[model samples]
Target: MSLFSTPFDPARDTALVTGAGNGIGRAIAQALVGEGVRTVFADISAERVSAAIGASKRPELAVPWVGDLAELDACDALLATADAALGGITHFVHSASPPRREADHALAVDRRIWQQMHAVNLDAGFHLARELAKRLIAAKRPGSFLFLTSLHAGTPRNLPHYSTAKAAMAMLVKELAKTFGRHDIRVNALVPGAIAAGGVRRGSRAGAAHSARASRRGQ
Candidate 1:
């Protein structure tokens, strides 16, 4: 056996992946199930949740959980449901974020839009990761957390809200990683390039919008 083999034994671990109904989150959940890890596909849309499960290589290991992570209550509900259904969650991936509307520019973006973005991308991440870490510490079990950030985080995208939220999440990743290392809990961020995922479908308006922004920024 390779000395570098991952300690993540899917057979004994359970994962909760947000935004799993589609896109990057969906892909991650599918991979986890393929590794024999039981996973919870949490999304805002029930239909999307069903679709994700249907597409999984091991649907039996995938549980559907519909909730709006942007809302604190929904986050609480998700934790309770996962506990009741899976007994415990040893892995977590926060990839749930509102769609990047082309209209949401620096000035055009309203307070509600900013709040929603932060609620899902920033606040929800902190709450969920912190709570899970607490549980793991109390139980003396190792766990892992992965947050999906954006390239726009370090650079300016003219979309202040999205970039700011992602930037904050990036820092949050470090903070969690440092604080939880002593407990054998891992925390990291996955910054992806433009992938043809559910959030920004190929040739979709959002993709075009993003491209336009990049072009303007001389990216």
Candidate 2:
């Protein structure tokens, strides 16, 4: 009998990535599929989901799931769909967040917008990670989970909704990592700078805010 021997074998890994319709999420899904991992790409738009899967290096290895993860039901549906499609999830990535507009600042941001941001970024991240960890523990398998947080987690970004949600996510990462470590499930946050992608556009006020923060740090 032959055995597979490798630190991380892409061929045996199955991943589910949210907000994979564009930008950083899209890039991560593509990279996973390109490495032979069966990746399930979940996004809010059917069109964008299709486009992301189409653009993947290995379309066959990429599965498309479109849903609004901000809703609890939608988040549950996504997990069910991934389980049905992939049998078992080995890698989980929560990168989906509502578009953060510059004009949507602290005083101007609507209450609903604040709730939506936390629902998607913080609520969904916690639910998804917990559910995935449950399955991995049940199957006695080791897995890795990554949440797409931001540098704004520690620094105020002027956008209360976005910044606060990210800050909460950062704490969630630490808590999950500590609790799930015994189960061999690793949880972490991928804090990214201002990238001119889907939601974080160039020349936007949010970008300017990030730049200002970076400058202050440098000083």
Scored by lDDT, the top model is 2
Per-residue lDDT of model 1, residues 1-219, tens digit only: 322257457656999999998778998898888777889999999998999889888899988999888889999999998888888899999999887765678879899989999999999999999988898999999998999999988998777888999999999999999999999999999998665553532256777777667657655
Clashing pairs in 2: none
Worst 10 residues of 1 by lDDT: 194-203
List, residue by residue over 67-171, the lDDT tens digit for candidate 2.
898899999999999989999899999999998877788789898889999999999999989999999999999999999999999999889999999999999
Query: TM-scores of the models, in the given order?
Result: 0.88, 0.88
**Model 2 ranges with Cα > 4 A deviation:** 1-11, 201-219
The global C-alpha lDDT for each of the candidates, from Candidate 1 onward, is: 0.87, 0.88
The TM-score of candidate 1 is 0.88
Error of 1 at 149 (Å): 0.5
